[model samples]
Target: MPGDVGPLAVDIDGTLTDQNRALDARTLDVLRAWPAPVVVATGKAMPYPVALCEFLGIDSAVIAENGGVVVIEQADFLSVHGNPDAAAAVLADYREAGHDSGWGTVDLINRWRETERAVSRDQPLEPLEAIAADHGLVVVDTGFAYHVKSPDVSKGQGLETIATQMTFALGDTVAIGDSRNDVSMFEAVGTSIAVGNAPESVRAAADYVTEATYADGFLEAIEWVGTTD
Candidate 1:
């Protein structure tokens, strides 16, 4: 609502980072200059996206842990979804099977997580799905890692909440991501973009797929929003 483009929801990792998960200087500058409200939507823990926004000098708007946690510029406006206990039970069953969750013994990745847990992509999806099902949890593959969460939680839900709070319709929001987990958001937003590096499924879910990859693709997506009706 701050500008003509309305609010923007963007994923981190493969969408905002390079192949090495590094943010380019150009990407940073473009984001800082984005005309409207920008939300850092990622499958990372709360601290990661919150810190990213803080450093970017934008409103500390974030939808972290997929849709597990959400906030738009103020501590009082924070909203959280899902149940960590359910995800924990799933993780326990997974560990009992002798497979590591991918973060090793001291998992800094999940240390700050409140609503759900993230599993390493190195694990087989079938086995993980089985464990998650027993605990009524769903595993969302973000192309970077597998997220163990409640089926009820998703980025789409987060977008709805943030859009309402920001006084914008879902049709006024543009989402940019690069993974299967972003599909829910794609389905809910006015315009959805997938980076060129995304898989066929992800690309198919998007309204537009940038020819470029990574941060460059993110910049392309920003332009895409401007030109889009």
Candidate 2:
């Protein structure tokens, strides 16, 4: 099963995109041409991945907000599995401490975030983690941001559900990512790839580590799974 491309669960921030978070035009072309199923999994807001799928011209299958929300395309399957209220508590305390989310007042990062809150990577993590723990929420450092979410929900769980619904075995899938937030996803798939820019811990967790960084690494991963290099 590992010999085939099979299904793909890919990350956005530092895997499909460059360090500046721009989606790689080169990777976009490759992704659309993949013969197997593709799942856009990200720590981003729900609308972001959904919109990406729309632009990619693929069906809407996504695991957004670090698995806080799962949408199975045209099947009308929408499952939200996090405590936004708890996440809000952490943010509220963060504000009380005279700290902003650091994305400016508009806070587009968390504005459309329904199931959780995303704190800018520049913000101090200790206080936020304390607040989240007080509210029974967990904080995940995705390298791009700190996500406050429920412990029960994860990208791994989301992939498992989507795999079942799509009628594919987990052993037939591949996952590519570049952050600790992707660790769960790495564990869930049969073949896991860590981009060159990924943290050492993330790379250690993956089944293979790419020589190239960012979207290039994504393309390298696809090639390893029997897709065109």
Candidate 3:
């Protein structure tokens, strides 16, 4: 029942967007009409959540840069504590490690392209996987871009933080996603749903699968919830 639920935590990438970053009208409706608060949990940067809030007409919580940062309205709750100096230090370590391991440039954005080629070639999977594993980074396969981020920062970690801040009982919230990053959300929410077009691995981790993609998936999940509890 809605009475038991406090807030809704949803992912943004595959759950809401297609090959392009288009918002689904059906899914937007669910989010707009939700009686409880809505939280956008994503691997995107701070700007992403801000843009979504404006688009969705929602003024609520957001988890960005994976789980490293969080904002509710204009207030920041959790943070990755970015400092140019500190970032430089970490980047230096990353570069040396990447170089030693036969990895490419420490430039994350550029390295991602190289990583994709490696995955595509199916040659020396260990090199790519090792870099991520060594740094406790989770490799986010976005089809267009691969993200290697600190293990502690991600959609799942963001969901945990959102749930805690909202005082929402774990068994009362619903989460939706379409990738491995979403597995964390699936594990965190009372209901874990995947879109019909989700990867098999994602489907394997979900409690339910929708018959649509993007906004359609979100709408399906909402409709399912309306009928069930």
Candidate 4:
């Protein structure tokens, strides 16, 4: 069954990195020898995941911005959400509501994002969801940050698009993640693994939950999937 599986789609940030946000050397070594195609999916900016894929020698499509943008062949940026203006407006509303918002870091906070906008998750989700709904956008929690994008866009849709292009069935892909944003991909794929650091809701949505956190958890999930029938 391991041979039957297609590419391995892994989430960056909390799933790939430790608490300090750096990739573990041991995990990187495992990725270097990974048999299947590895796709980097994350709520971080497109460049971050793409660069990591390049470093790991992974030449597959990357799902970025909580599935708002998909990068194919490390060249073109396919906008899955296609509503950057609306996303920005919703973020502006969040700011007006006295919530701190930014696009990741303070320096690039004002920079324009083509598909999705990032905000602090410290704010209540209900009010933010209402604002996003008003602008036809969806709010996703990425553990570290909250992303606002189009309702039609999701990690599930991103994974589906990549699977179609790569000529693999959605069931053949294994999605690994550790946050609420990964729930979409969890629902899309036949096998979904959640890291130990994942919230309770995320763990419940996953087919299996790893005993370890961060990259250790990632490796655990990968080995389990490779050995299980």
Candidate 5:
């Protein structure tokens, strides 16, 4: 069973950080010392997670933009699905219509993204989903933002792709998250853990729910995995 456990794929925002959105130093050290590979799967831009990986000195794969982009071994990034420009155009239309449909900041709005485009979570999803559907795209609510991406692109698919590249079975992977966007990965992996701060729906979907929140919960997950199997 120990051999069956391959890698640990973790969500970044609410799972890895506290109220301040900072990674705990102890958690980073624990991950560095952990025997298994630790992959950062996040809804944030690719650069953010990539930078974090570099800072942590981890060589594992990274799932960024809520699975819109995947970075393997710190090599080139791979776009998972549809064109981001098309999605951006739809959001632009929404903006012209006086709808509050834009990224949180101008910097994020101008940032280079490959396959996924982000809009404010406050925007109505029905209208956005309709627009995305017209362009063969879909909308996923990441709690913090609404992602307009291809229907085929998801955190689950990204993780599965990474697992295949690493020559590990999908059943051997462990996925942990605290948001709706993470549901895909939770369904994709054999083991899923949800932090205490996660929504009820997210917690219900996980195989285990930690008593702690944020970094402490993540550390608990790692320790639980170590003791199991």
Candidate 6:
């Protein structure tokens, strides 16, 4: 089972895009040609990645909101993970702490930016810590969203669910990504590939590194798997 391959979990953003936001066409074509199923595991909100997957012509599951949410179909939301009550409690705690910390839309981003400047001498985590402390939340430093996730909800768990449903052994999985949030998926799968564009930490943890980006990176990964034992 470990030798047999299964579904691949690929991340978006830095891995798929260059410094500017553009999907590599060649990479996209390679992914479309993959013999095994492809599942997109991302930290972006559902709608964004769902749209990306749709554009990519993928018909697989999308793990979004950094595993706080999962969408099996473009229209259906699968609450496979994340604790709503805990998330709410954290939100309330942030507000009560006078930080006005909560996740919403562009409004929240601006508010956090202001708060970020006011607190911690321009350190973002100052207010971030205040919010986390109030809510009793585990803060994942993604350098973007603070990621106030529920204890059990994660990309790894979501991948496991899909693997089980597909009758794919966990030991046969290959997870790829570029962000720190992807660390969980790396740990959960038998093989993990980090893109050339991945962060230093991510690259260090991966079993292999792709010479390509997006679908190209995915294609390199497949080739690596084919050649390795």
TM-score for all predictions? 0.94, 0.95, 0.74, 0.87, 0.88, 0.75
Which has the better TM-score: candidate 2, or candidate 4? 2
For model 6, state the Cα shift of residue 222 in Å.
Answer: 4.5
Best by TM-score: 2
Model 2 misplaced regions, further than 4 Å: 1-4, 227-229
lDDT of 3 at 101: 22
Choose the strongest candidate by lDDT. 2
For model 2, the local distance difference test gives 0.88
Candidate models: Cα lDDT each: 0.86, 0.88, 0.63, 0.79, 0.79, 0.65
The better candidate by TM-score, 4 or 6, is 4
Q: Which stretches of model 1 miss by more than 4 angstroms?
A: 1-3
lDDT of 1 by residue, 1-229 (tens): 1366767789999988999998777778877887877888889998999898888988888898989899888545999889899888888888899877888789998899999988888877888899998888888888888999989988888888888888878887789999887888999988899999999999999999999999889988877777764
Task: Rank by lDDT, highest first.
Answer: 2, 1, 4, 5, 6, 3
Give a tens-digit lDDT track for model 2, residues 1-229. 2334678899999999999999899888877887788899999999999999899999988999998899998677888989998888889998998876888888899999889998887888999888889899999999889899999989999998888888888887889999888899999888899999999999999999999999999888877767432
**Predicted candidate 6 versus true structure: per-residue lDDT over 1-229, tens digit per residue:** 1234566788876666664547666567755665676778876666676777788787757777677666666335465455545555655555565654434344433231101111111234665665655555566655345666655667888777667655667687778787788888999998999877777898888988888765566567767877774
Lowest lDDT block of 10, candidate 5: 101-110
Residue 66 alpha-carbon offset, candidate 6, angstroms: 1.4
Q: Model 2 clash pairs?
A: none
| Model 6: lDDT to the true structure | 0.65
lDDT digits (tens) for residues 157-208 of candidate 4: 8888887776777786788999888898999888899999999999999999
Q: Considering lDDT, which of the candidate structures 3 and 4 is the better prediction for this target? A: 4
Which pairs of residues clash in candidate 4, taking residues 3 or more apart in a chain or in different chains?
Answer: none
- Per-residue alpha-carbon lDDT of candidate 3 for residues 102-135, written as tens digits (9 for 90 to 100): 3335634323121111122222334555655554
Which one wins by TM-score: 3 or 4? Answer: 4
Q: How close is candidate 1 to the true structure, as a TM-score?
A: 0.94
